[model samples]
Target: MNLKQEMSHSPQTVILHQHPLTVHTCHTVVVGSGAASLNAADTLHRMGQTDIALVTDGMNRGTSRNTGSDKQTYYKQSTSFTDADSPLKMARTLFNGGAMHGDIALVEAALSLKSFYNLVGIGVPFPHDTYGQYVGYQTDHDENSRASSVGPLTSRYMTEKLEAQVRRNGTSLFDRHLVIGIITTPGENGDPAATGLLTINMEAIDDTGYGLTLFNCRNIIYGTGGPASIYHRSVFPKSQAGATGIALEAGAKAHNLTEWQYGIASTKFRWNLSGTYQQVIPRYVSTNANGGDETEFLEDFFQEPTPLLDAIFLKGYQWPFDSRKLLENGSSLVDLLIYIETQVKGRRVFMDFRRNPRCADEQGTLNFDLLGETARQYLTNSQALLPTPIERLKKMNPLAIDLYRTHGIDLEQEYLEIDVCAQHQNGGLAGNHWWESNVKHFFPVGEASGTLGIYRPGGSALNATQVGSYRAAEYICHRYTQPPTTTDTFLAQAEHLVQHRLKLLKNLVVNPEQPSNVLAFQQELQRLMSRSGAFIRSRPALAETLHRFQDELARFPNQIHICHLKELPAVFRVYDMLIAQIACLSAMVAYDERQGDSRGSYLIDHEEGTHRISHQGMHFAFSLDRDFRDQVCETFVKLDPPADSPDTKQTTDAAVAAAKVTHQWVKVRPIPEYTTWFENVWADFRDQKIFDEKRG
Candidate 1:
């Protein structure tokens, strides 16, 4: 069958209510086909909306492998002393870890333990005990029964299961179709109502690459995933190419764009041990000059003295020093470290584990065992890391084992050599608890929406996707009143956008210098972000970084030419750089205003007393609009400060009296002026042409 004929005969077309070219229509159009998107589609179909289509840039080998192995294990679950360890406690931890930037309502929604269990019930195969209690495990920073893994492949497994469900629901899957932009029209309150989508059918050979196809719908969900691919090293698949950039280009305002997380480690290779090749692991922690562990810095700031000591305190054990008081200094310590590392060192300082000889051997053993077990399981069951067969991996990726033998690094090692790598961006399309962006009828979910704020807890990505998607569906299904069909203005606007995008795509293909510019800009942006914005924060570095970013913006359009339409990879790179710039500016401003010691990742240094301390009552500033102008601002509330006991207050009062110091207590100002910090970030982004070009 011909391409058009095949599409017409496809099951997806059979379920559609109108022809593909229809002007005014209502059909379900999912912008992504990832786990979240699939869930949205299933839910909509269950709600009786069968006129749907799932669009994506064809599945890659990574999609199935993305979910790690299904080996389930159990461990003791503990809570941080600050958290009561209840569901509410988990929610609070997520907020604090996120710098109190996530939506409280969404957090509350995600606290439902049943949500995780539901996935399990739907064939997720979560690890469980004989009595059926869910298995839990401990990770790097989590405190609480927060994580349960069905091996490393939990994400991939869940996605496949969701995809299966989507198919069963009769929802059309448009593989290899990319959503270029959202089709929006102004609503009653000047909000842009997302009525449909503008897409490119990449499958057709005759596809001019300029033909803009519109998929009309009352609601649009962006499950386009995170922007981690912009970084040099990332765990995400290459297919996750930051489609949110296109969304942002289409008038979506992303919040928390200035809080990109860095420091991640991915498996580099595997080794052979016990007649089996193991996955060789690399060292993956950030460190300082003295080689006194950087984690020690966090410990000192938190006043725990050590990780085990902190664990002990969390168990209600008391120590000689007040750990709570010590943690208050964490923020300052982080800032000081950043200043020293970036401004003084001139070279990237990392917690290098390559110096540890044990890294290679330990990692190798672990990799061999893991692969052997996985291979065994795959042979037993027809499934082996999704579509890739175990036999094929053994034949095709022999270097995975060869690299380990040649290098000392093995995957079994507990401590791997690690360095700070650029992580997830905290900012994306700005949204409320409902997942509704500034643009009406448009919903941003997962990493695409900066709803979770500065830092997300270990498993919060799953939580965010589930809750955000559910809430977005709820909002559109409940709150919206379908607009009249006679409104040709909405469809007309979509048509115009389609044409404009086509022209841009054409220019991209025809332009000669775009590819080189893209590569150059990408390198420049990565260097700038790494040098000034990576782990630590300081004013001088931040200012210089901003200047560099601005320079890039000035040189980008003129120097780069986008000739090959397929070479639009630079668009995402440019988008990520701009996003990173915003995040760095915001973080820098916050660090400048913050007076205390280091807490968590937001660190600054002070001369005396304990170096590490956690700051209480810190809040991040967010805007509903993407322009980040001063006009639209809101401060989300965070955890309350530690309360003083009656005895402590009385003792303080008595000490004051004993000193015989007659003093007037002046009203203290709220520290870390959020508004000023926000303005700095906004102005930095606004001053750049990148923002303007995107806005236009």
Candidate 2:
């Protein structure tokens, strides 16, 4: 068989699962095929609506099916009758994270109970005890033990269950179709309302590249997942190219574009190395570029002044990489050390759970008894104090090994290569409490909708997806019978958009310069993002990167030429990522430079230093350049209304499509109250007790 036939027959391909597209009109058009999209469509069907079609670039090409850690978590109402945890309380805790989320946290909390039940009805098997209690655990940043799981495939299970319901309900499915942009009509409320979608045919490879398909509908439900793949080292599934840029292009406000979550993950499969993976105390092994010189490196960095076991043990609760961990020679120092080892010292690092980490002396050797008092006490109490790291992992979560085994990494016998990687985005197509964007009828669901504040517990996103999707679905169902205000002018405007996009794609396909290959461009963008855009952000680098990207934006479609029809999508995805990075980096720099301190995942290193290092042929690069090191930091942040403030004017549909609307750095307000933080992390550890009640 030819390559096309071979790819078409692959399970990942959309051809085998292709559903006929006959009707162009529907009440709602749901973009994406992830759990969030399918759930939204399923909810629509249950609400007795039949005219809805779910579109995706390809079937099962999302984080829901492709990403997992030792275990995936889902949050909801407190299942323990002895504990008092209300949705309002959940909302308050969410609000405490930061103002980036606004009031959507409240909405998410209020609806999570019903959302959890909806998932149960759809067949997600969350663990429940014999007493009819849903036993829960404490995840990162959560003060309460509200999270539950069904092993590492919780999201995969959700996606499967949701997909099955979607199929059973006979919701229209359009596989291999990518929604390039959103179509909106001006509503009676003076806001732009979604009326249709602009899509690309991924199956048809022709001279003009992707075939365009425009679907007119009253509501547009966007659930394309997060911008996780925008960075060089990311835990996102390979195919998750989000539509946040298009949503922004269509005049949807993006919230908390600055806030993001970063952690260590395996580079090969892009799976997170968190929770039990850290609790198992894996050996931090490094190899030199020539591939011969090897060393267990963590001990060399943590010298005698810092407690090695304490730092390693802390990695369990503090899963996300934080700069503050560098203070007093803390655990986060492990991330900085690994970053330097890999990116600067020309070495590769791996997490070897096959053996417990080795130490400088006999007493320093990692053991269950050597762990910080809290970790040691808990393991001893739970009867999980195993000798080997893999054994400990099996005791804590056996599925962690099975997950890796399924991915060809036998945790019992092999090392899981890892690096500090981009895990999640706390920002996306900005939407409201009900998941509605600035544009009226456009609803951004799941991670695609930036409803989260600065920081959230590990599994809160799954809840956010369920809560946000269901809320958007509820709002959409209520408006099911309401007629869309589509007009001759709206159609004319929509046609203009199609012509504009076609013209752009034509220019992309028939380019003479071929200035840069999609891979090279993608690499450059990812490198730039990983450096100045992520974790250890630099103001000068961010400014320079933005200036560079703005130039490329001007030359877009002309700069990157597509030689093949299949390459067309990459060009657009790269474009989307570039634009998204521009917005993300800009917000990150703006917010970090002002805050001037570390909080949650938003950390900016203000240290003054310079060094010359080599890594994989790249020349010397500083985390903070001389210009920025000497520059003054903003002591106080000037307050302004939120990005979706009522005062902001709605851009015209023509203006939105014409690229007339720019991503302006709006004035940010002061920090709100009800913030959650711990002066002593160990206190939180003692109080929350890693979501276990051993002490109790």
TM-score of each candidate structure, all chains considered together: 0.62, 0.83
Best by lDDT: 2
> Per-residue lDDT for 479-518 in model 2, tens only?
4466444434445546655666655665554444454477
- RMSD for all candidates, in order, please: 17.4, 10.8
Considering every candidate listed, which one attains the maximal TM-score? 2
In order, the Cα lDDT scores of the candidates are 0.46, 0.69
For residue 197, give model 1's deviation from the true position in Å: 2.4
What's the TM for model 2? Answer: 0.83
